[model samples]
Target: MELQLQIKMNPKLYLRDPEQSPLGRNIIQHSILMIQKIGFEDFTFKKLAVEVGTTEASIYRYFENKHKLLTYVIAWFWTWLEYQLLYHTNNVKSPKEKIQVVIRLLAFQLPDQFTFSHIDRNRLYEIAITEGSKSYLTKHVTQDNKDHFFKPYKDLCARIAEIFREYNPSYKYPRSLSSTLLEMAHYQFFFKKNLPGLTDFANAKDDAGVVQFLQHLVFSALKKGS
Candidate 1:
C-alpha cells in the first residue's frame, strides 16, 4: 500500500492549490531548488518560471509573488514538522523523551526520513533556517496575519508547548519557551556556520553539539521552579 500526507493549507495562501496539478507541483518543487541555489533575495518569479520551464504568468496563477510562495513553502515545512513531532512522539511514554525527539527535529532532519514527493524536506529545512522569517517580516504582515498565513508555524509551537506542559504542568512559560526553543535551533545553526563568533559551537562540523545544548537548555528550564 502507498500513502501520502496531506496538509489542509489555508485557501488564501494561493490562487490555485499547487497540489492539485502537475504544473503547480513543479513550481513548488523547482522553486525550492532555485531558492536554495541562488537564495531568496536573488530568486524571482521570472527566474523561477524559467527554471520550471513555465511562464511567469503561470507561476503567478498559483502565487501572488515570491513572498507568498516563500510563505507557502515555509508553511509546508512547519505543517509537516508538526506532523513529524506527532508521529515521532506517539509511542514515547515520557514527556522528557518526547521533547528530546523534538529538539533533534528542530536541529536537523534525521536520516531515513519519510519523503514527501513534491517537497524536499531537507532543502525546506535549510530554507526555513535561512529564509523563513522573510515570509512574515513584510509591510503587509498584519493583513497576512489576519488571514492566518502563519498558522502552521503557530501550530507547531503550540504542540511543543503542550509537551512542555505535559513535562511540567506548573511551568508558566511553556508557549514562550517552545517558540524560543525553535528560534534558538534555527539561529544557532545559522550563527555557528556563517557568523561563528556569535555561537560557542563555531568549530563544530555538525549539529550534534547544538542538539546536546538544546536538550540541556530545555530540560533545565522545565526543571526550574518545579
Candidate 2:
C-alpha cells in the first residue's frame, strides 16, 4: 500500500518534530505498524520492542501501557482529522458547501486514515461498535468524562453548529442541524459501513453516492420549512 511504502521509505514523515529524539516517536510508529500487522488483542510490548529495536522499558517511557498507546493513537487520528477539516474548509463561504466538502474529505481520506491490516481492521471495528457503546454509557451515566477520541469531531461539530446558527438564527435547536449532520455523516461511515451487519444500510460504498446522500439528507432536514 502507498501508506506502507511511505512509512517504510521515510519513517520521519510521520514525525512532527525533527529535533525531538526519534526514539519515542519511532517506537510509537512501529507499535502502530505492529497493531496493523497483528490484531491489537495479540499485540504486546515485548513483541513491539523486538520488532522496533527497543526494550520494553524504553517503550514504557513513552507509554505506560498498550491501552495508553491505543488512546494516544486514537487521539492522534482525531487531531489529524481536525487538521484536514480546517485545511479543506478554509475560505468556504456557504455552510452547505462546507458540509459537502467535509463529507467528501472524510470519504476520500478513509482508506488512508485507517490503514490497518484487514484482520486488525475487523477486530478494531468490533471494538468500536461494542466497546464504544459501553464507553458511551459509562461516560454519560457515571463519570461524565468525555472521551478524547472525539475531540476533533466535537470541534468540527461545534464549527458546523456555529455556521448553522449564523445562517438560521431564529431556528430553535440546542445545536445546529449542521452539527447533527456531521455526526450522522460519521455514523454512516463508522457504523453503517464498518458495522453493516448491525445496521440496515447495505451496499453503501464510500463514494459520491454516500456524499450526495448525506448532502441531500442534511439540506432537506435543514430546509426553510421542514
Candidate 3:
C-alpha cells in the first residue's frame, strides 16, 4: 500500500520539532508504543527513555512533559484523519453519497499501511479510540487551546460539518452533528468492547454492525430536515 501523508501541527506543542531529527522522530515513534503498552497515566519519560535508549532529559527536550506529548500525537491523528476524509470524498459527486462515505470513514477500522515509516498508525488509532479523551480533558486544556493545540481537531469537525451543510443547506446543527458523529464512532466502539451494555452492538467484534448503526443514526437525523 502506497500512502503519502503529511501533517503540519502547531509548533508550540513541542519544545523542539520532532520532524527535525532522527532522534526526535524516534522519541515520537517509541512514545506511541509505550503509551499503548502502558496506558498514558502509567507512562513516564523515564520508561520511554529506557525504551528508546535515551535519557529522560533528551525526551523532555522534544516535549515539555508527557501530556504535551500526548496532545501532539493525538493532534497528528486528527489531522491525518481529516486528510483521509478529504481524499475519499473528493471524487464523490452526490451529497448523500459523500455523507455516507464520511460515516464509513468515521466508523471503519484503521488500515495497516506504512504511510509514515516512523509512526505506527494502527497503534495510534487504538490509542485514540481508548485514551483520546484524556488528551483534552484536563485542567490545562484552556491553556493548550490558547496555544492553538486543538486546531486540527476543530478543523476536522468543521470539514465534516461542511459536508452536512451540503447535504442539507438549512441544517442548523451541522457542527454539533458532525462532532457527535466523530465521538459516537469512538465511544460506541469503546463501549462495545469494554462496557457492552452501553452500546447496542451485541458482538464486540461486529465492526460492520457498528457502521450500520452509525449510518442509521446519521441519515435518520439528516433526513428529518428534508
Candidate 4:
C-alpha cells in the first residue's frame, strides 16, 4: 500500500477571505458614491444605509462607526492605487523612468473613471485636505495606519531616491526632495485647477500640460550632476 501526503495551503497565500464583511463593502462603496455626489462633510450613515438599501444597524455591524467606515474607504483607495501602480510599473526599467511613471500616474493622467469627474475629484481633494486635522474620519488613525496608506508612496519615493543617490552621492535630502516632487506633481493638477490664483503658475487646461510642467519642474530642480 502506498500512502500520499496532501498539502494544505495557507489561506493567505491562496484564497484568503476579505477582512471586511459584505455589508462593510456595501457601506464603503455607498459612502464613496455619496461623498462623490454630496461631499464627505454632507454624507451621513443614514444616507449611506438608505442608498445601499440596508439598515443603518446593518452598516454598524461591519463598521464600528462612521469614522471606521471612512477609514475603510480610504484604505480601499490606497489598495486600489497600489494595484494600479504595480501593474503599470511592472515592466518599466530604470528608477528614473519609474519615478516619471509615478509622477505621470499621480498627475491625473491615469484612466480612472471614478476620479475623472470634476465633482468626484473635488470631493476627494476635500477629504485629503481636511482629513488630516479637521475630519473625525482620521481620529483613530495611528502611525501604523498612516504607514499603511503611505506604503505605496514610500516605495515609489524610495525608488526615485535610489536613482537620485546613485547619480548624486551628496544628495542629502532624498526623502524630502522626492516628497516635495510628489506634492508638486499632484498640486499642479488638484490645487492649481481648483484653487486658481493661489500660486504663480496658472491652472493647466490639459492633463498633458500638467504632466509636462511637472516633469520639467522636477528635472530642472535636480543638481547638475544628477
Give the TM-scores of the predictions, in the order they appear. 0.95, 0.64, 0.94, 0.67
Off by over 4 Å in 1: 1-3, 109-113, 224-226
Better of 2 and 3 by lDDT: 3
- What candidate 4 gets wrong by more than 4 Å, as runs, is 1-21, 111-170, 199-203, 224-226
Order of candidate numbers by TM-score, starting with the best: 1, 3, 4, 2
Give the lDDT of residue 76 in candidate 1.
86
Worst 10 residues of 2 by lDDT: 5-14
Q: Report the lDDT tens digits of candidate 2 across residue range 91-204.
A: 888876776766676455333443423123333333333233332343343222333434544566676666556555555652656556655655766656567775445575
What CA root-mean-square deviation does each model show from the true structure?
1.6, 7.3, 1.7, 8.8
What's model 2's TM-score? Answer: 0.64
Clashing pairs in 4: none
Per residue, candidate 4 scores C-alpha lDDT tens digits across 1-226 of: 2222221211211122223346544554566667656766787778888898988777666655555455444444434444556666778766567657766666645654233221243355445433422322344446534436345445666766665565466767777777777667656554565676664456445667667776776666666564
Model 1, 36-153: lDDT tens digits are 8789999999998888899999999999888888999999889888887877887999988899899988976544245568787778888999999899899999999999999999
Candidate 3, residues 101-177, lDDT tens digits: the string is 88777765444232788898878987998888898899988888888998998999999989888888887888999
What lDDT does each candidate get? 0.88, 0.54, 0.86, 0.55
**For model 4, the run of ten residues with the poorest summed lDDT:** 6-15
Clashes of each: 0, 0, 0, 0
